[model samples]
Target: MTGERRRLRFRRFATRLERALDGGGAVRRRRRPGVCAALDRCGLSAYYVPAEYGGELTDYTELHQALRMVARRDPGVALAHGRTFHAVAPVWVSDDAVAAHRVGRLVVGGTRIASSLAVPGMGPEPHTGVSAYPVVGGYRVDGEEWVGDDLAPGSYVSLLSRTSPVATPRAHSLLLLRPDSLPGRGGPSGSRRLAFCDTRVGADALVGGEGRGAEIVLKARQLGWAAGSALPLGAAEHALRERLAGSRPPQTRRFAEAYADLLLCEALSLVAVRSVHLLPGELSVTSAVVGLLVPELTGAAALAEDAHLCREVLAAQFRSLVRGHRSPHDHRPQLDRLFGAAEAVVPFAPERIGLFSRHGSAVLGTLPLSVRRLRHLARAAPEFGVAAGHAERLLEVTDTLHQRLPGPAVTGDPGLGRGYALCFAGAVCAGLWLGGGPAVGDGPDGLWRDGLWLEACLTRVLAHLGVRPPSGADGALFDRLATVMIRQYEDGRPFSLLPFPMAEGEPR
Candidate 1:
């Protein structure tokens, strides 16, 4: 599907899915069959499969947008439906004709695939998740894989197991297994708590080649992290649409800041997704930027809402933020590794390789528009004196950060990675504002020109850098955002990159 077609199709699906789950009742309940049928009918399942395999996933941008749409309505359905692609990504990159063809057939046939990549004994240790012993025709597999209820009849799992005696992280290989084909020791196959015991597979089941598990896992994770940002983006929209419906001062401020934060994240995700296509080599750093900033943005939005609502708001946001993982901390180790890698890969002087510097024209093409943005923002600064010169100062910092980059030879410091990502986000946001780009979805006025939201965004970077905000900065910015947010909510629209129109008589 073309970009416009994907958006139109997914929007149609989201509308129907929302109505079905809402059931015209006060409480909205999600049923697997209803969700699957809706999605299947719309050919959403094809997004998971590659085009050559009869699916429509041409790039990460489409996947991100599609997942964001589902995530806005039902997180559980989004994750369950999307995780299969996470597992299949490694296979897709492997370029193994046979394996790709097989997976493609299953995906086109509407069969769900699960992953057993992260099993017990998976660390760099003597213990291995599953061992592949040499046999006549192929390697016999022996181990256990714990998984949730994602598996069922006709479903398969992509398993990573130890194939060589080295017993190291790099010594393993990947296998796409059929659970029913293996003899199960115990546990219900249909239950979410099922653990496959003594699972075995032949040589042809191997994903690409022997001892490629470590490399494959890393690539797959990068793809997953890049796509994962959609969940938070959608969740933020969900929370804003549901919780901020009043015209009161506090509610209005929270809504404005929330919307600004959403823009930063939305831009960050788009840049990262495009990088995968335009600069796959830099994905190591770009994906890390996405992984770290997404959680940061989600938490920030939740915090803003928490200040206005009760603990329930925070709890719901938390659940939406960390729904598919083992725990919130699950992303920490991966984050650390990615960050460490980023310091080496991220150019301090990004003009040579920066997305905004090189690719900004593709997204925002008018210099006149950019100048108007700066003027509008400049005009609004008088009202919130606390953020005076902050936007310009941030632009200056962006230049300095790029010039100061120590080059790719130095080992990356995780702390430096955080600062770099913030600097990158600030640069992109400021540049877009300067160009007077339109908001994700709004009227002729460039949304970023709102003095209040820009100040809030600049203040956030300053706070992160340990700079104290001017007196009344907090209160002034909050009140400013609150007004905008309230107006948007009253209009009955989602605070999204491209805002969705609400149905007639849709419940708030």
Candidate 2:
């Protein structure tokens, strides 16, 4: 299908899903089933499966967009439904044909697979609660695992179990088992707990291999961190909308700062998601930056309501950032494609994703060039002067940050990590603005025009990094962004960089 046609179909599907969700009401208890059914009716499950495995998941960005759309309305529901995609990540990365096909068949048949892989912030280590001892036929499993919150009798659970007695990275193994095959009971927060009391399965249950679980799960979590960046973005977008509503609104500066933060989040997430395909090896740093910043920014807006989720997400990013290796690599072409919103991305290739980045973040490292390009544009158009100035400030702070950054083994400073993430976000905004090509006659409307949004975002990033702008300068940028935001709100559009039209009849 043509890109336009596919986008149209997705928009239609999004509209239908929104209508279904709107009919479900605000009660969380009643909303879960409705959300799942709505998503199923819209054929979202198919996107969770790989194209080679009889599904339409040709690109990670497509799945990210779908998840973001769902999350805009309900983050919890989005996370719940996103588990299916998360569950299949290890299967895809492992490249085990049998496991892939089996999981694919289940997913294609609309079965929700629950994964027990340690959450992102929980480190790449397998859950210590579960262990599988080698038995005659298959491993004898014994332990407790927290599966999906709303799993049913026939649902499948992907368990990460310790396979070796020794404490080693390769000691864990992944298994796909049915809930009915094991004894499970109710757990907290509506989750199902699998109590495997010497349960045995055939060798076919082992995913990837006996000692490859850690590698598979690590890669899968990286994918999760990159893709799940959308969740917080959507939630922040919702918060901005709420802030704009009602007779009395917050101060314009506050609302505008919130909007700028959301734009920054989107910029980072856009690059991170596309990196999964274009620059997978470098994704370690990029995804970690995204994972750290999204929640931090969104949590400040009170959008990331789930504190536990934020903690896990932050913890994961912290570990990845501290362990990531930094080597310079040429990724200019990839960066161009990543920033170009209309560009078609390459297919998802999980094999390219590495546990540690051999090359550091191309986005952050390329900041100087992006700023130089912005300055050059300013020289020609004059309208880009303000944005160029902000970009230069961002460059100064980034250079300072580089000097303070420790080597891969030593740095665990949260402040330095946050500084790096902010710089990365600033770089993305500059790259995206420049990627749009030289602005002609003051640029297009909304955020793009006059580089207004870019300047605001840069200013916000600088402030986060402790570089306060000149007096009155910050307020002016905030006022401009707030005006644009109010316009979007009045026009029934989402408060995003793209500002796509919200589903018709969507509830406030």
Candidate 3:
């Protein structure tokens, strides 16, 4: 499914999603039951379960359609929903399978909803009955954690603590508690009072084992992350399609670069989503290894790709249209934020750049010398925003790993060269998300051009790497993809590629 055919097929789904989104179906989940019951008529409930469980599940193509539709309404909402979509995995892994089955039955019955598990501080806290420890039977489960707004009545809540068991001390375990177990125990008497604001649910509470809470939490977060990661990709795709459909051809290269990002993210999401079904423990931990490496790799690429897209859009139309119309009149202060949006990204975001390189080196380093050789060198690459001196220092460590390891070596003359290409692919996708736009038939132009343009650039950049072909038709696919993205970039309406403003008064 590459090139024009892929686009043709997807375009229809995207259009369908757009209609659903515009019809307010995008956020039907959080609304009143009657509203959602209407959406269910549209057959969206199929999206809620695994294919094995009578749901269409997260089919890459379908997800792309669904998310693009929802995101056009609100990226934040799409993000929030995505994070909670697969909220069932942690419970499925419960040591107390009986309880897991009970919870499953509730969900199947539409009488329940569940928030994902998260390290306590990572998520909001609730008012009452949080268990205290791996207490009498389980770890002390005395505490309260908030069920995010996405949670409806009868929805389950998950939390994580930093306890380690004596058996597998190196790793963490899981615990499950249901909504019924409220006010199970209060904090210290003198400490403080736990209050419930608008908190209401049934009573037979409890989920996983007490001490194993952390495991479920981590799994939930990963599930959430995988789901969240897909959104930007979908949105980026939507943006590219919308931009390319317009009259003008893009003058810049960023659109294509962003497209590459969309493609890469879709692939990563496919893999990450599959990783969700794994039983807990070693394989799950390995999946985490994949999780840590993903964002940093593709996330960086996405940012870079989007930055380029924004640059293209702003340069072409935004500077004149958006800036000219608003800047001169300058009546509404809010409009100013749009132009100022493209503030510079500081030299290499070390956290961003180092993520893949460091994580890959940490996990993959244990492999054969040949594998380690090529893999480690990537962490050391110089980033656009990174300081050269520091990048150089980092390079030293990477260099040592590359040089010391000896295994599969690309011959100097071997057509394919050496570099961290996968990570680079990840960066390309991330770049598209930030600046991409709406899907076609959804409405007017979106930042789609930027996605397409960025897609073009990423392809060009990746092409420079040794063209070691991918498994199947993927080789020809990337090649053709590069062309599509470039075309999209060359032919779309422009917008400023501004990073989302973190606070009020900041650029948009």
Candidate 4:
């Protein structure tokens, strides 16, 4: 990183985090909405827009830093900003039209609510956009998307449709419209379907073109993946600071590993960002999605527990602030649920990671853990061995890697903390898998080694959690990951050699 870049990062932090130091009593309590809006008005909302569109032209690093800063002070704001970023992503990836139609629309705030695939129980549809849809002119939109979240009530919405679905619609279309526009027909409609946890925000509108909605939405979700890393990364950082500030407690090992979780989050976050640009092959989207969701609580619980352990430490006010800031799942603002959203997205959430590590060994499903497979398994063969066999394979491969790999160095590595967290995070994934959550879904493609780092981290983290890899879960998880790595990296050939890494003194 350059000196200027470092300073710029600090400046960005200062700009977004001015709220942290404003008042007293856990800055989360008694927030000043006016301050938040003012900051957004000042340029916070346009952080990712290009210079031509009146944004800071913020790069990936700045966006990451800004998310951390905002999340650190108030995750609520961070989440809201995330939604906006998602709202605008279509423009960023909207081919040529991205600049003129979609990007230009958000630059001046012409739309209202933004809903991506996360919108209540939605699923992905195969690509279906025509280069020139509906042959008419301008933009015409139809169909209704479910709306929830606080933005629902009476907010306008920005939707993306497969351009080809409606001819005359331009490619990479971005549609901007109002909820009221659905006068029983035309120009995009709405329905009461999935409810988003983040519902505090007010109002909704539209952005860019209509008809060509899906492309914009897809681009946004893709770009939004990088930002997704920010959510848990910030939580992990705060957890570490909270634990370090406490008087040593019984949870020391878990605390330290949790501290490491933040580093892993950052490393993984960077990798995810690169994946956005580099476009890795054989990528598993849901696997990637769940990968980010799982480690969130590994760091979160460590922070919450340590804070409760030493509530007297006045310096650890962020803990209280964290408690005060409403999460995506907080049904009531006053009785806010801690790490609610983070918890829902993954199984074995909160202290479940530690609990499961102790007794419950997780086994993931092999028949693709998508909505379709889940439904099929649930309805057809409820007693299928989908989870157990997969679990055994993971454990087998993991042990092989441990035997083959060099002993991990324990000194002077900048990412040492990350190394530790990956072990636990991996273990946590295993636990989640046992609980019917799928982990390590990427089938032999695109930096599986990075995922291995996470699994390796889980091994160490499980020990810190006082978990003995109960029964056969540990061994099973190992085999699955090792087999995955070999099959993915070894050119899809059967492994004549054992699935192991190179030992320090072993001949190649």
| Evaluation by lDDT, superior candidate among 3 and 4 | 4
For residues 1-508, write the lDDT of model 2, one tens digit per residue. Answer: 7878777776776776667666557524465767786787777888888878877777777778778877777777887888888788889899798888888888888887888735423353545678887999887887777765457756788888899998777778888887665533322224566677767777888999988887787677767778888888877776677767743765788777888888888877887888888888877667777767888887643423333433343334443333332334453345777777657778777778876664455666667788888889899999788888888988887766665564463244556666777888898888877774442223324577778878888888888888887788667778878888777767766666663434743333
Error of 3 at 287 (Å): 4.8
Taking the tens digit of each residue's C-alpha lDDT, what string does model 1 give over 1-508? 4556755765675565456445544223546556765666666677777677667766666677777766666656666677777778777766587898889888767787877635322236323466676576677776665553367777777767778886566677887877765675523344643344555557788888887776676566556667767877876766666665444344554566667777677767766665555555445555556676666776633322112111111122222222222223322211211211111122111112311121211111121233345656557665534344665565555445444444452223344445556655654445434322333323213244444445676677665655655676587566655555555556655454333432323232
What are the lDDT scores of the predictions, listed in order? Answer: 0.56, 0.72, 0.36, 0.38
Q: What's the best-to-worst order under TM-score?
A: 2, 1, 4, 3
lDDT-wise, the better of 1 and 2 is: 2
What is the TM-score of candidate 2? 0.88
Q: Give the C-alpha miss distance for residue 57 in model 1, angstroms.
A: 1.4
What candidate 1 gets wrong by more than 4 Å, as runs, is 1-27, 117-128, 184-198, 245-250, 300-388, 395-414, 431-446, 450-455, 474-480, 499-508
Whole-model lDDT for model 2 versus the true structure? 0.72
Tell me how far the alpha carbon of residue 181 in candidate 3 is from the true structure, in angstroms, after superposition.
Answer: 8.5
TM-score of each: 0.71, 0.88, 0.47, 0.48
Summarize candidate 3's per-residue lDDT along 421-469 as a digit string, tens digits.
2332333233223212222211122223323333333343344342322
- Judged by whole-model lDDT over C-alpha atoms, candidate 1 comes out at 0.56
Clashes of each: 10, 1, 82, 58
Q: Between candidates 2 and 3, which one is better according to TM-score? A: 2
Report the C-alpha lDDT of model 4 over 83-186, residue by residue, as the tens digit: 65665655654444434344554544523355533221012332322122233333344343553223433344444444454334243344444444344443
RMSD in angstroms, candidate 3?
Answer: 18.1
What RMSD, rounded to one decimal, does every model reach?
10.6, 3.8, 18.1, 20.4
Task: Looking at model 2, report the run of 10 residues with the lowest lDDT sum.
Answer: 319-328
